[model samples]
Target: MNTPPSPPGAERTDGSSVRIGVLAPLTRPGWAEAGRHLLAGLELAVGEVNGAGGIGGRPLQLLVRDTAADPRKAAAAVDELAGLGVAALAGEYHSVVARAAATRADALGLPFLCSSAVLDALTEQPTRWVARLSPPQSRGWQLYADFLLGAGHRRIAVAAQPSVYWASGARILRDHLAPRGGTVIDLDMGALTPTAVCDELVDRRATALLLLVGHPEPAVSIVQSVRRDQRLTESLIGAPAGQPEFAEWATSLGDDGAAIPFLRYLPERLSPLGARVGAALRERLPEAPSFVAFEGYDTITVLADVLRSHGPDRALTADSWPHVAVEGTRGRIQFSRTPGISVWQWAEAPVQVVDRDPAAPDRFRILHAG
Candidate 1:
């Protein structure tokens, strides 16, 4: 299960099928369960590509490895896939898991492409073999910051989980807000009790709140606590990929409180993509509660574009590898090289402000695109 050589790109075994390793958290629980969505997207991409006559005359042979959303496990899965002689890798939703895949790919000389790891530090290296379809969290924060400042709201309170992506966003917000003479208080929730954290934000009288947590239930708890305990009535802005439970949670607020989730792709008016994904997941995957299916779908679509441009070349040559270009669910993607010798990649893509809880049936606005 760890290492199985897939069909080579140039061979006739299975008539030219290239093995692409898909590392995801198929066994994890909770809102992080969005790994299934990541898988679905990747599988969908493969199906579409194969249906169109495959990549480089070779149909994709996907070898899925469950990272279980664990860093060490993810690393192990990467090694196993490398042993299997997979041509490339695509699918890493978490920051720690993405870094693990990037590191192992560098050592093994394999191409590692992440579907959705927004940490800025992942691409600080000379490893061009590693790429990410998801834009960094800093870029996402920039979009949010610009939107907030443009709307004439100078004072902002930042609340984020103590994860690498959130930490990076917090730092970026500080740098952006300070230059404009705006005050930003770090409402870091990773260290404090949920109740205490809500109380502080409520007592502070903030003009706006930024929710940067990853999982949906934790975010739901935060929203519930903020409303129940803090008695704070303020607008919440966050990256669309932050949590999928926003619309349902926001709608439950009964029109008084709004949860404006910034997203990679907004659902159609009166028909959000999340709702559709949620329904499909409910039937197909009753065991898995929460999964980021769009993340999977988006990542695969982007990686396929890279493969389309650059055929199934095993050797990851720096100069020859074409930059990943794809119209993903998150809009346009242009990954850039990082300065340091790290495994991370960076890109600044356009983001849309999706009205998770539409006041009207046809009221989904793309407030600011990226």
Candidate 2:
């Protein structure tokens, strides 16, 4: 809940700091830790950039606000940051918050770069000032469907939390796999006990279980319950992307988390630059870096590139973003106007399916990549 103080508008005495506003859910019920990790990544990138002489010899300063995962709060945060006269805007994890921030940024004509919010509708319009670095939820779901079908999973059982994000992801999964002759069984985790859910899945002869829970505790509970039932040993259990992308989700599940597949931005093999960044991140945070952190890092890195190429002018910053194509930790950070996606989005963001090792839960092995 402690928001960073806003930086002085581009008119500071030194006139050598480029201020960028970061809007995230730092104290929201379900988004606190994720937001913290995101901030860590952003700070790391800022440190790296500053060490390299910054953009056009101007140090990048981040002025952050807590959205608390609320749409109205996100919009207000954008307005406040704009009032501070930031050169550009970035950082948001929740889709709903991102949508609100995106709308406000477009209206204000501020360049806003979204990180890790997967809602398809975020990019379904022609908002010239808004761009996203993450692929849409539909693409992620399609990847999940492809993985399931390739693994010979036909009878699929889905257990989803009642959050709007989870519900939308579950719907996308069902819509994608059902048309391919896969038998989809939907269960609301909020209305059913884990034991009962497992029993039904077992009784229905489900070959795969897709968990769409976004938070850590519930996701761990369901995974533990499913793991306890010996009948599901051969069944493929997937956490999709959002649930298991957090370090807490895997750590909370502990050894039982092994072999449960999930989507991630980092590949099993890291690029040379990625290895250095990963080491830097591990040294700073108590836990290993999650995909969200990588996303935050990439967001700032790309933003810096934009500022460097177009200078620190706010108007030029907004104009140069659509043409940005810089390489980051994950892959090339490029924004193209795609139909039904954000006006300028990195539609081909690389994602991979990975599972924790049974012997070492912290370590993971890649199952698929695209």
- Highest lDDT, which number? 2
lDDT of 2 by residue, 325-365 (tens): 88888777777877777557897688887788788777777
Worst 10 residues of 2 by lDDT: 5-14
Score each candidate by Cα lDDT: 0.61, 0.80
Show the colliding residue pairs in model 2: 123-341, 123-342
Model 1 global lDDT (CA atoms, 0 to 1)? 0.61
Off by over 4 Å in 1: 1-16, 29-33, 55-57, 229-231, 235-241, 245-258, 265-311, 316-319, 323-348, 358-364
Give lDDT tens digits, candidate 1, residues 228-328.
65356554545444553333444444442354556553333213444554455455553432334555666556556656666666663232334555555
